[model samples]
Target: MKVDRGLLEKINFDKGNGLVPVVVQDVETRDVLMVAYANREAVEKTVETGYAHYFSRSRNELWMKGKTSGYIQKVKKILIDCDEDTLLYLVEQTGVACHTGNWSCFYRTLAEGDGNEIL
Candidate 1:
């Protein structure tokens, strides 16, 4: 889907101190890849480039996924939550989504199952 650049204005960035949480999911598998934050500029860049761009809270800057690791996330659709305070990104993931070489950042189970099992 073509993202409307004007959608940026609807995001409630101020609710999160100039950033909104973005949930990244695999388009086909429906597996949630990761959760990141995006500021206005990051969201705009993602819309402009058709790739996932997030604001790194630690780095304090905008960064495109896979800019160095070659695990780029090609955004297929962007959805805003009911309150417009959060975002969901359906994407085509190129490689492992986690830096630890896991398919997803949520590999480990935290509930009643084996904690080491990859979900």
Candidate 2:
């Protein structure tokens, strides 16, 4: 689902203090890559550029993924959750998605669900 600029109107940025969580996934592998925050401008830039851009809470500025690292993520689709508060970005990852040189940021596992676990 490629998003148009109009889709931005449906996002609930106010809920997250003018930011929204974006879950990035590998379009080919369907693997979760990274999670980042985005403000309205970031989202607009993403839609305009066809690349992943995010708002850095720590830096207090907008950043385009891979701008410095060259591990760019080419966005294929943008999906909004039912609540229109969160977003999922499916992208074609150029290289490792993690700054630690890992394929994904979620490499550590604190707990795993067993097959018999209840909901």
Candidate 3:
């Protein structure tokens, strides 16, 4: 879907910190890959290019994922929550979603039979 300016504005970008949370998921498998942040420019860039881009709060600049690490995420679809403060990205991922090299940022799972520690 082509996001018009008015629609984009309705997404309620968090300009207070100049960033918005972007949740990336694997569209086909429904596995969540990673979570990142995006500024207006990064959001626009992602829409314009069909790839994921993020605004680095640490670096204070725009950065494209997989540019240096080769873990690029290809955009499949984008959805906004009803409140429009957060975004969900259905994507095709190429490599580990976590910088720690985990398949997903959320690596730990609830142990099926054991309640002591998460898997």
Report lDDT (CA) for all predictions: 0.91, 0.92, 0.87
- Location of the lowest summed lDDT over 10 successive residues in candidate 1: 1-10
TM-score of 1: 0.89
1-119, model 3: which lDDT tens digit per residue?
47667768777777688788999999989998888999889999999898899999889999988899999988978898888889999989988889999989989877466577766
Kindly state the number of residue pairs that clash in model 1.
Answer: 0
- Using lDDT as the yardstick, the better of models 2 and 3 is 2
- Expressed as tens digits, the lDDT of each residue in 1-119 for candidate 2 is 35665667989996647999999999999999999999999999999899999999999999999999999999999999999999999999999999999999999999989889997
lDDT of 2 at 52: 94
Q: Of the pair 1 and 3, which is ahead by lDDT?
A: 1
Model 1 Cα shift for residue 83 (angstroms): 0.5
Clashing pairs in 1: none
Provide the lDDT at 106 for model 1.
96
Residue 34 of model 1 has an lDDT of 95
**lDDT for 8 (candidate 3):** 81
